[model samples]
Target: MEFKPDWEQAVRRFEAWYAFEETDRPVMIVSAPKAPRQDPPAPGDLLRRWTDAEYLIARHEAAFRSTHYAGESYPHCWPNLGPGIAGAYAGCEPVFDETTMWLKPLDRPLSGIHPVWDEDNHWWQVTLELTHAAAEAGEGRWVTGITDLGGVTDILAGMRHSDRLCIEMLEEPEEILRVRDGLLEIWKRAYSALADITQPVNGGTTGWLGAFSVHRTYPLQCDFCCMIGPEMFERFVLPELRELCRWLDRSVYHLDGPGAVKHLDALLGIRELNAIQWVQGAGQAPTIEWADLLKRILDAGKSVFAYASPQEVRPLLERLGARGVALAVGASTPEEADYLVRMSAEWSRP
Candidate 1:
């Protein structure tokens, strides 16, 4: 299946969101199925299938064939070797399972383990190759996304193990900070390399979220923040995050769950941070229940990207207004998708 997206309108909606200006409505991206799609690989071949560039490309094509991308939605494939791939690039061994991959934390002391970016790293080479292959396959069809290079603390957790890293924060704070600072340069370098490889093919930059930016943009996150106190967060995590925000042209903080929400004020204060994508994890109140929190983010003058059901659309629009909100809605049918878009436009009108 081929995709001819409304490139102009998509661009306009996104630009308005970034500028905090009013458009026809908040950007609504709907992915409704047109046909039954192939299921993902079963447990045994999951890692193997993900590593195969041809299989990855073909899988994405087949998935897109079964869906209709409407409103601000566009077809994009974010090539990833899981979130811990950044740690793997820094010499940590990645242990892959049926569903996900994680780095094997160092057993020795922090001083004994050295983290350095190896251009020749096996995972790095595979990631680059997969990126190139996806771009080639997506030519004239879809946009390819930047791989998920997680934040400083999150990557460190993979290398040092989350539990030990927590102890390091208390026992050897300065040393931990030093290691994080050192990794900053490597992170920037890796991002630059991938950006260079993907820009020509994507015509711009985007990430797994499917939002487009004329300049480079990706979801920046620190899942480890949940384990640390606010003081430790400021001392260890915030500075690195600030520096990254300043380095990137555009960025969205992936605020994962309630534990991370405690740092919301600090995150919102960063001038260079463009948006916040809230993931209210399982068993938490649905997306609609967080209207007050979402409102605070908006009132702080930052954009929000969230997933919402059709029933929650009008309420969200009423509560947050439409200036800088983007919703990723999964509609059961194309007709429902069209209805939601129309309703959002109506609610947005002055």
Candidate 2:
């Protein structure tokens, strides 16, 4: 809260945004480069860049300190080993890349492999090491978020390959559900493990969605849901998602693109879900143009978050109102960041 004079005020905005309640303005996360930008030399090897805890923490701290975290944006680091990391924790080997890690599928059916948390999995260890280092470095200086533990259905797809999982679901529905249920337990255990380290250090929680929570909060998602229809989603995905939402104090569904929007009605019906992060996907349209879809989510009484350019923020807020919307907007200067904060109040509606 020491980032600005009104830091506590910004926290209040986030709390209101989470509850879909009235506030002075919508919560916006805006960050701009420091006046004199600094860039460190790139690490030589991609593997070391990811697994080297010291290097990862240094980079996180550099970015955390150099940028101006405006609006609801603040210093937080999640040990991202890609979104499918839970698959690796369950025994699938991960092929590394600069941007994300790919979880290699099983050569045979996953009927034999029981999903459980491997405390000694290399990537899991990397996650813990990186998180521990970041937590120590950021103890009183910043808020460090939990790792992306991932969704159960997505982990199943990652382990068995999406197409193979589809066939397995049709051929052996009960076994597939059993494995999914096991993965759900691992997911819950992973969260509790990470929370044990993160919560007392900062007295709050956050996840890859870049939102803050006073207690347990997450951006729950199932990217594989896009490949399946509503019936399959209800049978395989919905039960676990519903259970997660019920267990967590705050939860947001990550609804991605037109493909997954088919499940929007079902997602909106979940009384425990607190919000939605609508990722409209690339090469389609600016999120500002999707007012009707966003308003539909809002009308369903769930808070929503979306992306916008700085120029789009005003009209976006004007159309959507200030009640239950949060946006991630980019700024190039401190003045522009300040302007967006003011515009939030100016454009807010009843």
Candidate 3:
């Protein structure tokens, strides 16, 4: 069964959510099927596959073909370079496994190491090529998403390694701040380059997160903030985040786990950030359990993007109403996706 999406209506719901206005219903997205698994890569093959333009484009096309887009969901594929690719572009070596990639920490102390963007870097070139190829492949069928560029502190943790960076935050706070300022500029350059390549083909900007915007939009995150206290977060991370928000037309924070909940107040206080995507990590309560937290975000005047089962949808709508909630729901078939979309409309406020 083919998943057909209502493009015009989806855009309307998204624009309403961004403006903190009520829609006829919350934005309801149906999840696509998992791409069929491929055999394990031989030594060196994974890197080769990632860099090969034809291979990357074909893989994306196959996945887009396999699923149905329903309700607020739309088709989008980002080159999967993992979250630390931004750090890799800035002079760190990346280690690749079967499913994802990681950055090798710098061997020297934070004070001695200087990170700069290398245009000729192998990973950087691969990222640029892959993005262009995906854009070409997605010409009429799907949207090409921006790769995971990661946040300022998150990229630094990849280069400096999280544990060492934590210690240095105490020992060399000034040095850390100086490095962060430089990295923010590199991050902006990299994001702008990808956006330039992607915007025309995508028909608008959208990222790994499925929210769509005619203007620029991408998910901003700092998983490392989960490990730090709020004082350190305010001092080191907030300023860079503010600058990033100011640069984008629309932005959403990816709040990863319970550990990062402490910083929500600070995040809500940022006038430029339009929304929050709260991810309650594994082994914890599901999204339904966090209605209070979700309510607080809404109360603070920011929209929310969350995951919920078909069974949980009515309760969430009843509790949170339909003003500013965007929900992603999973279904096994196109018929199921259609059913849920109808149900969502019924549950929504008139």
Which is superior by lDDT, 1 or 2? Answer: 2
lDDT of 2 at 131: 82
TM-score of each: 0.95, 0.96, 0.94
TM-score-based ranking, best first?
A: 2, 1, 3
Off by over 4 Å in 2: 1-6
**C-alpha lDDT of residue 16 in model 3:** 86
Q: What is the C-alpha RMSD of each candidate to the true structure, in Å?
A: 1.8, 1.5, 2.5
- Deviation in Å, model 3, residue 46 alpha carbon: 1.8
Q: Model 2, 50-161: lDDT tens per residue? A: 7776776677767766788888888777778788687788888888888888789888765797887778887778778878887877777778888878888998898888
User: Model 1, stretches more than 4 Å misplaced?
Assistant: 38-46
lDDT over C-alpha atoms for residue 172 of model 2: 95
Q: Model 3, 1-350: lDDT tens per residue?
A: 12235676777778888778967778888755644634333335777766677776666566666767778887777787887688888888888877888889888877786767778987788899888988886777777888888888999999888988999999999999988887888888888899999898766788788788878988998999988999999999999998888999999999998999999999999999999998999898978899899999999999999988877888888788888888899887778777777778677664
Model 1 lDDT-worst window of ten: 39-48
Clashing pairs in 2: none
The number of clashing residue pairs in each candidate reads: 0, 0, 1
